[model samples]
Target: MARIVRKPGLRRRGSFRDWLTMLALFAAIAFAAAYLGGSEPLRGRAIVVDGDSLEVNGERIRLEGIDAPEYRQSCTNSGVEIACDKLARDHLRKLIARQDVTCTALGLDKYDRTLAICRAGERNLNEAMVRDGWAVAYGDHQWLEAEARNAKRGMWAYGFEEPSDWRKDHSGEETSRVSAKESVTLHAKRMFASLIAWLKSLI
Candidate 1:
């Protein structure tokens, strides 16, 4: 058999420091892999989509489960002034104006909008809007339910204002004699400040 002589120290096992270095290296590699995987979908050129929304390379992202005021959707209904939705959208836009926004996307939603929790630097856009009465927390389940509930923000402030769903109030005595479409159109013109004097009342 060939002689195999080892130095006394060379034969010794690795110390705690050596183990720690190995462990840290492995941990760092694992962490990097996880981070990169998590960040893949959310990476892209960001475009603003209203207050609580943004586009990741043109994907419509709703700020997580949070619901901002309905904007560019329905402003008027059947000629009854549906002002709350307009108000909510306005407040949200102002809150997130020209901020460096980052978002953690969960995935695509039913509406095809990316469901994400947006952030403006340090502030969470979802929570901020709800906290400031700028938007509703959206859906029954939310991370910051207490903020909207206790603060009575957004739709909570309006006892009569129903969100997204307006059918809940239908089938009762209509607010005015005008049709819903006519009312909505009339209000839209007024909101843009172009409603004529007779046109306003005719609806």
Candidate 2:
């Protein structure tokens, strides 16, 4: 019988290859977990604060990438005075009606509200508002804004002051008053009540 011969360094090479394979596998897993694990999807009913602001689960979120009119801002359409801000808010309310909202929290804004990209069903709320001309694109939504303008949608159909300009002209007290008045309306009141109920159910 021929004596079995151990190949020089073969066992060592096999062990090294095994180690490398294990290391690569672990690296792939670590990469996947690190990239995918931290995303916590936000979902809940919402309380619309204005056209571009809302609250979900007690956390205020300012819709990122757009700006809407202030709650008391006004404009003129065909020489007729219009409450552009209320119109914007009401449009948002209609868009978010009875839908579950989802948001990806980007970070906090200067006002400490969560800046987020939010969606209600298939609609990206930020883009939708811009496309509908109720909100102006702020960050990366200029294309949507231009499209809305070209199509003559929402604010484009009527002459309106930019929301930022409107806010700049108003005092803080006036702004707050408008928000307070809006919150007391029947629709807004019901929305707040629903928000409370939804939160309670969660606990």
Candidate 3:
């Protein structure tokens, strides 16, 4: 019986293939991290979805720490009716002005939108919106809101309902409503997604 001999190059090729597979796997994980969660920043040209919302790289981001008028909400400026919602949206669009926007994800909102503090160049979009009176400070930027109010800028120059108040009054008309059970389900999904992203970062 002849003794069997294994080629050295064959084992080397097998090892290289395994190494390649691992590299590909890690690359995929990193890509997922960029989108799913982690500290990876989302950067791209942003489309103003609303005053406090943006679409970047196909991702919907709600500007953290601020709230803007609902899309159908209106306000009065100098006793003249104005589309405050459109005004806020237009102002945000002007601020962006086709600039590259970068957003750092904080977490997810009840709407399942990524909550982020975004910037265009050196300007913080959240702060700018509040400071300019296009948005109201929700969890942050109170000083900016005060400044805008004192200056009588944007919505401060007009009479309008608070975004949250408007939402409550128009809840019946608002289409984003989710049932109590659905909200809990979505919240769990968000938590799970966050955990998975975190684990992927470790690899």
Q: Which model scores highest in lDDT?
A: 3
Candidate 3 local Cα displacement, residue 25, angstroms: 22
Tens-place lDDT digits, model 3, residues 107-158: 6656677778899999899999999999988565899999999999999999
Candidate 1 to truth, TM:
0.49
* TM-score of each predicted structure versus truth: 0.49, 0.65, 0.68
Using TM-score as the yardstick, the better of models 1 and 3 is: 3
User: What's model 2's overall lDDT?
Assistant: 0.75
Better of 2 and 3 by lDDT: 3
Segments of candidate 3 deviating more than 4 angstroms = 1-37, 172-203
Q: Rank the candidates by lDDT, best first.
A: 3, 2, 1
Question: Which stretches of model 2 miss by more than 4 angstroms?
Answer: 1-39, 172-203
Ranking by TM-score: 3, 2, 1
